[model samples]
Target: MNEKLHCIGCGTEIQTENPQEPGYAPVSSLEKEDIICKRCFRLKNYNELQPVSLTDDDFLRILNGLGTQKGLIVKIVDIFDFNGSWLPGLHRFVGSNPVLLIANKVDLLPKSVNKNKVINWIKQEAKNLGLKPIDVLLVSAHKGSGMTEAMEAIEHYRRGEDVYVVGCTNVGKSTFINRIIKTATGTGDIITTSHFPGTTLDMIEIPLDDKKAIFDTPGIINHHQMAHYLDPSELKFIMPKKEIKPKTFQLNAGQTLFVGALARFDFIQGQRAAFTVHIANDLDIHRTKLEKADELYANHRGELLAPPSEKYIDQLPRLVRHEFSIKEAKTDIVFSGLGWITIQDTNCVIAAYAPEGVEVQVRPSLI
Candidate 1:
C-alpha cells in the first residue's frame, strides 16, 4: 500500500497523473520531505497561473461554511468583468459579516478613466446584485498600486476579527493575497496564483497577527465567462496583460466590427460616429460591410478571424445578438471577458453579439 500525501500550500491530495488539475506534483517532487504542488511552485517562482475545475456543489459547500464563521469577507472582483467575475448568492454565504470589496485590475483601464466614477459604478453594480460592501477599494494586484489603501481599509474594518478573502476565479484574488503577504512579512513566498478556476481547493491561512489569520478560499467557477470556453493559449489574446490603448473606429450605419471570432458589433442605425473599443491591445480588430459580415465570418471563422480556432469552434456557443437603443449619455456595450465598445450617439441603435450564455450589457460609459 502507498501512503498519500497532500500539498502544503492548498492541501489538495497530491497526484502525478494530470498536470491540468489541482494537487499535481511531479514524481520526483512527491518524494521530498516537504513539498508544494507544481501549481503552487510555478506561482511562487514564476508568478504564472493555471486553471482547474470544481463542481458548483463543492463551491457552495465551502462558502456555506463561511456563514457560521466570524470574519470580515473581503470579496475581490475584476473591474473589467464585474458581472462575469461576481460569485452568485455571495450574500447568502456571508451571513451578517461585512464585505470589503476590492476591485482588482485598475491598471488594465485607460488613464483617462475616472477612478471616482468607476468606484461609484462598482458600488451601484454590487448593490444591484444584493451585496452591500462596507467599503470598496480599487487596486491593481499586478502593479502593486492602491494596495496600501486596501490594507488600511482591511485593518480598519476587520477590527481584530479573522478575514476571509473570497472571489470568483481569475479576479486576481491569489495575486492580491501574495502582495499582502509580501508587504506584511517582507517575504517573496506566495500562495498559488493561477488563471484557471478552482486554484485553491482548501483554505490556505496566513497569520495576520498573534491571534488572527487571513484565509484564502478557492475561487468559485463562473461557467458563463469566456475563459471557461477558450483554450489557455487563446486566453492570452483576449485577456489584457497591460493597459489597454483604446481603439477608435469611425463607422457608418452599415458597418460592422469583428473582435477576433469571439464577438461582433454592428452599427445598425447609428449616425456616423466614433466607437471607442477597450480590449487587449494585442487582439486583432477588423472592419467590413455589414452585408458581408456574415459571409466573412462564415469563411474566416477559424482563419482570418481567429481565437475560436478550428479546435474550439464546436465548443463555443453560437453568437447571439443583443440589440440596444442608446438614449441620453455615452454608453458601453460590454461583451463579458472580451471587452467593450463605448458609443456616444443619441437615439442610436446598435447590436452587440457574443456567445449565447456570455453576458452582453449596456452601462454608462466609464471614460
Candidate 2:
C-alpha cells in the first residue's frame, strides 16, 4: 500500500520519501499531501526563513529547568510596549538571581528624549510588577543604540555569572540576542527568525567567556499585544523605526488622543502643556476633545482610531482604563505595544485604556 505526502511550506505533492528529499512532510502531516509542509518548500526555495515554535507546556518546562542552573537574568523588553513585555513569573524562575532589565528600542524615542528617565521608568515598572532588577539598560537591538551601555551593564551585573535573556513575544528578544551574539562572537547564527508566534522555546546558550556564558530563552506568548491582531504590514505600523520624531500637541483639558487601539489617552483636567507622542512613525495619532472621545472612539475606533479592527474588537477582550494624575516634569505614560504620551511638568489627570490582558504604565518622562 502506498501513502500520500505533502509539504508544509507550499502545499504540494511529495514525489519521494527520502529523509532529505524536498516536499517531505512530517508523519503527522502526511495524511494531506496537498497541504505541503513549510519546511520542505522553504528548503526548496532557499529564500524564506524557517521558524521554530514552542508549546506552552514545553516553555514552562524549560523555565523550570533553569532553576537548577545558575545565571543572572537580562530581561529584554520593548520600550514602546513596556507593560505587555514582561515575564509573568520570572522572579519565581530566577529567584534571587539579580536580574538586569534591558529596555530595547530606545532609538524609537525622540532624539532629545532623556534616556536616564526611561531607565528610571523601567525600574518603576519593575517595582510595580514585583520585579527587582539590579539595573536597567536602554538599548535598540536593531540600530545597535545603547548596546554598549547594555553590554557593559550586563558584564558588570553578571560579574562572571551566566546571563539569561527573557521577554514576552514580539519584544525583539531574538534580535537583541543576535546583537549580543554579534558583539560577543561577531556572528548572527545564534538566533532564529519568524513572523508567527512562539518563536523560541528551549534555552539556547552562548558562552560569554570559557566558563561563564549567557542563555537566550524564547519569548512567551503575550495575547493582549496589539501585534497579535495585525498582519505583518500592519505590525510594521506600530513597530518604531531606527529614529523617532516626537509629535507634540498643545491642548487644554478635555482632549483625547488615540495611539492605535493599543492605547487611548483622554486628557480630562489640567493646564495642558504640550503632550509629545513618541511612537512608530507609521502609527497614527489623532486628537479630540475629551468630551467627544468616547463618541469618536465608538464611531471611528477600528477605522480612524484603528488597531482594534472590527474582528480584533469582537474577538479582543474588553478594554480596561488606568487613571493617572501626573504632577511633575516630563513623564512617559506607556501603553504596551502602542506608544507613550509625554506629559510635561504640570498637574493633570489622564485616563488610558487598553485591552484587558495588556499592561499600561507611566515612567518619568524621558523627553
* Among all candidates shown, the one with the greatest TM-score: 1
lDDT of each: 0.83, 0.68
Clashes of each: 4, 15
Per-residue lDDT of 1-367 in model 2, one digit per residue for the tens? 1765434333334544543333445566545535555543442344222333345665676567556567677887877777676767777877667888888777777778677766776787788788888887887788887888888888888868777777777777767876676677654343332211222222445666656767666566666676775665567777766577878888888888877566778888887578888777777788888888778877877777766566555555556899988877788787777777788757888898877777777777666
lDDT of 1: 0.83
**Which stretches of candidate 2 lie above 4 Å from their native place?**
1-53, 148-161, 183-201, 208-213, 308-313
Report the lDDT tens digits of candidate 1 across residue range 18-67: 88667889998966888888867765675444445567877877777788
**Error at 72, model 1, angstroms:** 0.6
Q: Roughly what TM-score does model 1 have, to 2 decimal places?
A: 0.90
Off by over 4 Å in 1: 1-11, 31-36, 39-53, 188-200
Worst 10 residues of 1 by lDDT: 190-199
